[model samples]
Target chain A: MIEVENIEDQNGLRPDGRRALELRQIRVKMGVFGQADGSAYIEQGNTKILVTVYGPHQPRGSTGRSTSNITKGIVNCQYSMAVFSLSSGERKRKPRGDRKSQERSLQLKHAMEAIIHLEIYPRSQIDIYVEALQVDGSEYCASVNAATLALIDAGIPIKNYAIGCTVTLINNPSLEDEDNALGKGVLDANYVEECTPGVTLSVVALPNNDSTSKDGLIVVAQGAGQRLHLSQFESLKARVLYGCQDIRTILDYAVREYLTEQSLPSLFHVALN
Target chain B: MEEYPPIIVRLAINRIDLNLIKNENVQPRIYTPGEEISSQPDFLRGHGTYVDDENTLRASVAGVLEKVNKLISIRPLKARYQGEIGDVIVGRITEVQQKRWKVDTNSKLDSVLLLSSVNLPGGELRRRSAEDEQTMRRYLQEGDLICAEVQSTFVDGSLSLHTRVLKYGKLSQGIMLKVSPALIKRKKTHFHNLESGASLILGNNGYIWIGANKQDSDRSEGGFTQDLSRIPQINREVCARLRNCILILAQCNIQLTDTSVTYAYEESMKYKINELLEPEIMIDVSLLTHQRLIQQ
Candidate 1:
């Protein structure tokens, strides 16, 4: 096992050559599947996720959970990883129906329920299914980002962009002379950095466009690995929030480009004037 | 020995460019979810806009902004069909209840086809007896397709469909294709008998049907009788060609109307029927059809 001290080099560069605040490269594609109502594929570094959204339609009775609510709609999510998704060169035994996948599915459902406007849909239900083709690190965050794009592709009404980002707090022994706030936290963590002895905080946030609030609303936050001091929590959250904002900008641009390419040419005659 | 077939492998970056055919001068205003459409309180909120905590109107879906007088709505590029009264639809019977049949019309909610709304086989004014309610499956069983019109809507947005007309009833021996509802343009007539000897029904719900043209004698038989006799090969070819043509038009995001479909079918004649499935051929055919439509 590698020590936490070697995660970052002496010149202030992470193992992947990214700075402390820099994120990995993100690529998004909307409406990748024709049969699904909405679908999106997102690649964040080496982690690849595909999310498909179906419904705003009548609820089904097959799941046996009693989804027949009369007042508002429900969001159902299923998270699964492929058998060959493990980055350590070994195949997973099961694709889904495991304890870890079920927990991630529930967390994804809660994050989706916060952004979706359920009242308008009434007795209908929306189903989102996430499939992880490759898992390096931060799989839940990639799934959340892909699910947001899929919901937008499906044209389901929602409050705002639900951006997910992971932050890691690495205790640096060599940077004692520098300021504590500058080099203590990293924006996104990969498999190597995640294995180190540090706290990895995964956050799903709704980045609002309102002028009053600078910090966006955090919908779901989960901390894993080592515990952190109470004083370091605020700065860790702030770093994750900043990372979420940057992701939102990239996703927003992709959506606009998709719309421009898919919009009918004839409708533009009536819209431009 | 038989020759092997050719396979095309292209990179994602080399996919056909859709913007090459679009008009450069027309750039529409696009909106995403939670983007503010209007800060004022006076604008009437439509289907895709909601009031925030600050009382300002924000778009709920991502699409182009549509403004009509004081009403503001964001129309998504593609979504499930929202039924309107008097619109034609093609649906499949999913279940048979006591007095109503549930029809899946590609809408948010399953539409209902009440027994009272359909015309009985005996006559137009015949009463619906208790035996008629029990034999509802005999008229339209599960998994059967039908053509109907939207009669009204319930408080929960489910549509009530009617098949009282002589033209709307159980459809038999046809090819059905589903496309995005946004690609279908609303026109005066949804049914068209093309010059190529094929009949087409462009359902507002995005379910398109292509079949042999029905004779005048078939209409007087209450539409329950089926013509099981084999259709001629020429008619089958025309139907297959028509189906491929409509798929091409939909893939290119061109509106599906009778005129545009006919133009596509005509332009696709240069290539054989199976050859139309090629990526380059599909793009070429749709481009020709688009150019012809602009000239009109």
Candidate 2:
């Protein structure tokens, strides 16, 4: 069995050579698909995901019949993984329609519903599709982040940036004696570390720009693996919130850069002046 | 046998410059969703904004802010076409319902085209009888394209379209291209007859139709007549070239107007029509056209 202490070295670096609170590198590209109303591609370290957003148009299929209330729009989501996405070199039998994928689809739909202003688009529906091309760890977190970018690309009205992050609490026996007031919790756990005897919590939050509060408004949070102590939950939540805030800054910068590059040359005069 | 070409791979880098507008003195203020735009209570909120519990006006989309006197709104870079009254649009028929046909106008909702609003084949002032209602499908099927004007909007924001004018009705023998609706500039006339013997319709919904120019007599058939005859080879070539030129302009973030499209077509004549599909050549032609437009 791999001990929790072995996941981090003596110099306080994790097995991936990252500090406890350091998140993996993230690269984002918006409007990758011309056919989709909005599309985005994101690479969070080794985890790659492509998300597409369609509609706010006429609802069709099962979504069309469920629209009994025309007062607000409906949000539909589908989460699927590629057949060869597993890192263990094992091919999967099916890409989707499994129980796990369906549960993830429902969870993603709820997260998107909290951020989108559905009331404005009455009698319409917005469909978000997330495809995981590669999965290392934190797949659900990366999907939420990529779906947010796709929604922005489609120009859908959202309340704020919905960022997803994972926090893991590693109980170190050696460090327990030295000032254990704040438990040791890592920001992002990879595949190897995810298998450790620790608790990993996936959090989706809507981060605001206000600096007064360090914690963002949590939209969805699901905990897995071993049980977590009550005292360490507060610190783990704070660390994950901070990670979400950092990601929001990066996404906001990318959005601004993309806008500056894509805006028409003639419209600059009217906007800048 | 032809020689196999060498495949080249390189690191990913943004070839296009990040700073497009060279003027360093002025910068546009862009607002993202949930960012507070104004805290003043008196300012009227427009589209792309909502009032929060704190009474502050916040932006609902990521785009540049537009303020007209007391009204402030944010215009996103791209979105579904929002119909306005009297705007010309091109749409494909999706469904045939009772007394109305559903049209996919690239909008948030499918627009409705009423049978009564169309002109019958016989006369202008002819009354619509039970026979006219029964044969509505024969006039327009499910998959036909039509040019029409926005008559009004329903309470749910879906548009009601009308083809009452002689120039509006079933479009035939044309090439349709879909681009982003934001790329189309609003002008007094959306229809243009190019000096190159082709006619173009720059629909506000970003559906461009390129076809041969028709004579005045052909349009007198009450707008329901379809010209099934084959267009000449030369006219087809001109239409194809114009279609490529318009697409290049749209890809380069240039506005689609008759003058800009004409400039692009003239500048693109140095290369073949297929060459314009290449990325580098597309940028080169659009750059020249952009310079000429600025000079005008």
Candidate 3:
């Protein structure tokens, strides 16, 4: 693992020179691959993830779950990382079917299931396959964001965008020396800070249509590393929630731009009338 | 053998605007998922919409809002084909079942081509028997492509297809191009024999078939028997050109009608057939075709 010490220099900036709550630059391209029903590629900081959505179509062949329902559909998700994704002059032997990838896959399904209206496509199954081409930090966050774009491109009906963001507590000696308030939390942690010996919380949030909940609706939240003090949980959750809302706005804008680019004059006329 | 042109790839910058042909005032209102469309109790929710906890009807997919009377729906720009009755489709056999063959028409579910709905090797009125069920694989095995019409729809939403007509049957020696189903305009006829010596079937499900022109006199065997004979080079070129033409129009989001396709092909004659794959040439051809359509 890379060195985790001195995450923030004396200037009160993270090693990447980002402020405490600054998110990495995000670039997204939808319908990147023509073969899939819907596909997207998202790059957040140094992490890049590609996602392809196959179907809300009939489940093919006979299987353990052969009984097609009349009311709801099934969500099948697969998460795989490229062999060269986590390179430190070393290669990964297996890309998928490992314990870590399987767990992430389950987490993604839960996030996706929350927003997708499964009842609309009864007796069908929607397959979401995500590949991490590059993994710096917050792999799961990038995966969820990429998958959401893929679902949007596929035109799958969803209640909301399932946005993911990770927040980590800064334990760097420089930050603690500066002031007590600096230790509260840091938003959108990179790989080194995530691997540090403090609490790192991963959150999957859905920005509510209304402002009733300040933190939006948290679909999934999991903490890694050392145990966190009960007092810090609320602030960390709020920070991550705000990060998710920011991401949702970016994604929404990208989707609208894509729609306008693809629409023809006749389609515009049809919509206008 | 004729020499082929090398493929050239390039980027397009400041190209034609897709909305160039329309009136300036026709800017479609766009909607995103979870965006509220209406909170009124009188408006009924339709496909691509669901009522949230507060009884607000919200869009489920990002696209444009469509309303018919009191029913409001959002039509996404791209999605899996939603099958409708009377739609002409080209599909590949995915499975051979007891008395039906499962066809993949890019729909929500695999469509069914029942034995009773098909014209047997003998004739259209031939009665299907248990022997026919046993020989189903021989008639239409897995991976065999066919053209058919949607006879009806099942309760589960899967399409029930028929090939009783002479024109609809096992397809051979053609190239299949898939595109977004929204681009294919539903018309009185989906089949077209272009003046350029190629036959095309623009499946409503977005699976297009371009084949060598076949004569009506060769309609024996209920259009089942495969014509393994070689397709002339000129006819093959025509099919290839038509395939590229449909793709270019689709890439530009132009409506895929027979007229648009023929116009695109006519405009593309200045460039080599292989050159049509180039990005700039494709835009040029589609743009010219769009101009012609607008002038009409």
Candidate whose DockQ is highest = 1
Q: What is the lDDT of candidate 1?
A: 0.84
Q: Model 1: how far is B55 from its true place, Å?
A: 1.5
- Give interface RMSD for all predictions: 1.6, 2.0, 2.1
lDDT of each: 0.84, 0.84, 0.83
Q: Per-residue lDDT tens digits of candidate 3, residues B210-239?
A: 878553456667767887888889888888
User: lDDT tens digits, residues B1-296, model 2?
Assistant: 99654554554573443223244555677788888998999999998888887899999888888888989888887899999999999999998888889999999889999988988788889898888888889889998999999999999999999999988998888789999998887789998888998888899998988867652346666687788888889889898899899888888878889999999999999998777776678888888988898898
- Candidate 1 residues lying further than 4 Å off, grouped into runs, are A3-5, A63-68, A172-183, A210-223, B1-14, B215-217
Task: For model 1, state the Cα shift of residue B245 in Å.
Answer: 0.5
**Per-prediction DockQ:** 0.68, 0.60, 0.60
Deviation in angstroms for A51 in model 3? 0.8
Q: Would you list the rank order by lDDT, best first?
A: 1, 2, 3
lDDT of 3 at A132: 93
Report residue A175 deviation for candidate 2 (angstroms): 5.7
Q: Write the per-residue lDDT of candidate 3 for residues A17-102, one digit (tens) a residue.
A: 88878899999999888889889999999889999999988786563157746578888999999999983546778999999899
Compose the digit string of candidate 1's lDDT tens values, residues B160-185: 99988878888887798999887776
Q: What is the TM-score of each candidate against the true structure?
A: 0.95, 0.93, 0.93
